[model samples]
Target: MIDRVRRFNRTVTQRIGALNDAFLSSDRSLGQARLLWEIGPQGCDVRLLRSRLDLNSGYLSRLLRSLKDDGLVVVEQSGTDGRVRTAHLTDHGLTERAMLDRRSDDAAASILAPLSVRQRTQLITAMIEVERLLVASTVLVTACNPRHPDARSCLRAYFSELSHRFDGGFDPTRSISADEEELTPPAGLLLVASLHSEPVGCGAVKFHDDARAEIKRMWVAPTVRGLGLGRRLLADLEVHAAANRIRTLRLETNRALDEAIGLYRAVGYHEVLAFNDEPYADYWFEKTLDRSTAPAPNLPDREH
Candidate 1:
């Protein structure tokens, strides 16, 4: 598997001219050119650029410095926040970026033009699958404090989505509570799934004295759905529950949440009688945990 990955990486880099000093025949290296493209027309936050590119601060700074030296880009402190910096392209830089775009299109065309129509279709289809899997692999799921900014963001989005999807519109106060205090350690823990260091999904498990745990706030951003993230979050939550000696895990969901219900059933959960009077719930699920074979609960607390 490792060899296959290495071979794929080598092939992609070579095919895309990633090893060239001047990518797409531009005057900048592949890294610099890609950075320029990421900066785009409206500009972007320096911190965001670093996170999205998975580049260290110093390396990103070096690339920005080179662009600045070439008079192709300008870095400025945000007026709204002195601590926040943004990178923008100069007029010359925009022109160069346009040229690079054309060149890149031509380069891609060169690759596709050599293949027959069927071969081109096959290559494109394979590329799409590869990109999807690569994206899925980058998502990092970790134990996060419910009070953390990312966790809070996910909760807010989750509630907002529920409000929109529910029949009478959802209200947290009227539903079963899974507050900050409840999600903290010893009581329970929240697992946040992040892509590019930004929270995209979250799930929480609340423990009880009787070796039972309840899943709460399980959600994944719409943009990141179909990546198997919901299943991943549920599996991790189950692992945490089992490691803590929990013998049973349960959750309740609204009938409107068909996807969540389907996921529960697909993952060995069984429909059960009302476990609790959750007003929004129309279905309840319970799962028996095999603690003897449960994986250790050593999920990371930072970017993976």
Candidate 2:
């Protein structure tokens, strides 16, 4: 099994230019090249980049220093909040990034050059699957504001999906209002998962300053439903609540959401009496997130 996995990795790496020393040989390491690409034209929050890359603070700081020393990027304090820093590529860095993009295209073309038409089509299909899986692997779950654009986007998508799934359809205007300030730090949190630039799933925890917390708006994109995104979102929300000293998590779901009910039960949530009079809720659940065991695995992406 290990050998097979290794072989698969080797094939993918070779095809994706991962083995190419010249891929970004101009001056930067692969990590730095990736950082440059992630920085983008609008720049990015340094803290966000760290979270997105899952890099240690010290290591990320070193990479930033290296880029700054090379005159390839600039880091500046946010004008609105001096404590927050943003990273932007310099003009030279932009030029280098463009070159990297071209190199990426060239590498892709190189991979296709040796393939017959049928083989090329098969390869592209496989590549898409691999890309989707890789994206599924990299998603991180953490506290967020429900009002954050990405979080809102995920909620909207979730509602849209429900509208299609429900016999009577759904309407966000009729759904419970999720206040932005309530979802901000201390009061509550929203967690969103994304693949590349697209929001794929979301969940929220609302803390009442009392011992109990409420879980709300749990959802995963239909395209990624089987990837375990729902479970990941649930587990992450529990963790966030626990960290806030919340002891119990309560949730309500519609009868139409049988899968969600099953997920909650399988993950240790118990049937509970109605906690709130949500017009849409037909089932209620409560769970105490036990930190004694390892948290549930992050959701895998739906396989094509």
Candidate 3:
């Protein structure tokens, strides 16, 4: 099994020209090439890079040092916070990156060069599936700021979905305000799942001064719904709450949100009296987060 997996990885790496030695051709490893691509034209936060790439601090630091030594990148402290750092590519670095881009294109073209038209189409289709699966695998659940672009995007999608699903047609303008700061750090939290460059799902937990938290605005995009994103989002939110010392979690949902209710039930949330005067809520749920047996529901994909 290990050999099969290793062989599969080798096949993919070879096909993608990952073994090439000109740096883009061979000298630098795939890691360095990917780092340069991620750096792009605008600089990126070092912390954000680490999270996005799912890299360990030591390994990421080593990669950054190598890029700096090669005169391809520079890292500087943030103007607003000395503790934060940003990375930007130098002129030479940009040129080198452009070459790498060209090489990648060439590599992809080489893969298609010998294939018949039908074979090319099949290959592209299979590649898309592989890409999506790989993307789904890489997505990590981490605490996030509610106001962060990805989180806001998820909320907007959530509201838009509610408007379509609800009898009255939901309106965020009329919806109760969700405090952004509450989702920032120690006090409360937001969890986001991103696949590639897009945010696919999110969940928020707002902690009271007591030990309880209100789970709010939980949502998964229609496109990615069936892949168990909702359960993952819920689990991540609970984990975030647990880390912050929150014991009880409560949530309210509209009657139209039957799937959510089912999810809550499957996850061991019990029916409870209304905790808030949510104009749209028809049911309320409360659960004491138990890491051992949280509900793991399989979310269905939304039909297009």
Clashing pairs in 1: none
On TM-score, the stronger of 1 and 3 is 1
Residue by residue across 221-288, what tens digits does model 1's lDDT show? 99889999999999999998888889999999999999999999999999999989999999999999
Where does model 2 exceed 4 Å of error?
1-8, 15-133, 171-175, 294-304
- Global lDDT for candidate 3? 0.79
Q: Candidate 1: RMSD over Cα atoms?
A: 2.7
Q: Candidate 3 lDDT, tens digit per residue, 17-76? A: 553543456467878887888888898889988988889988998999999999999999
Deviation (Å) of 209 in candidate 2: 2.4
Best by lDDT: 1
For model 2, residues 72-157, the per-residue Cα lDDT tens digits are: 89999988889989999999889988888887777768778888999999988987887776666777665556756788788778
TM-scores for candidates 1 onward, in order: 0.89, 0.57, 0.56
Off by over 4 Å in 1: 18-24, 29-35, 46-71, 74-77, 82-85
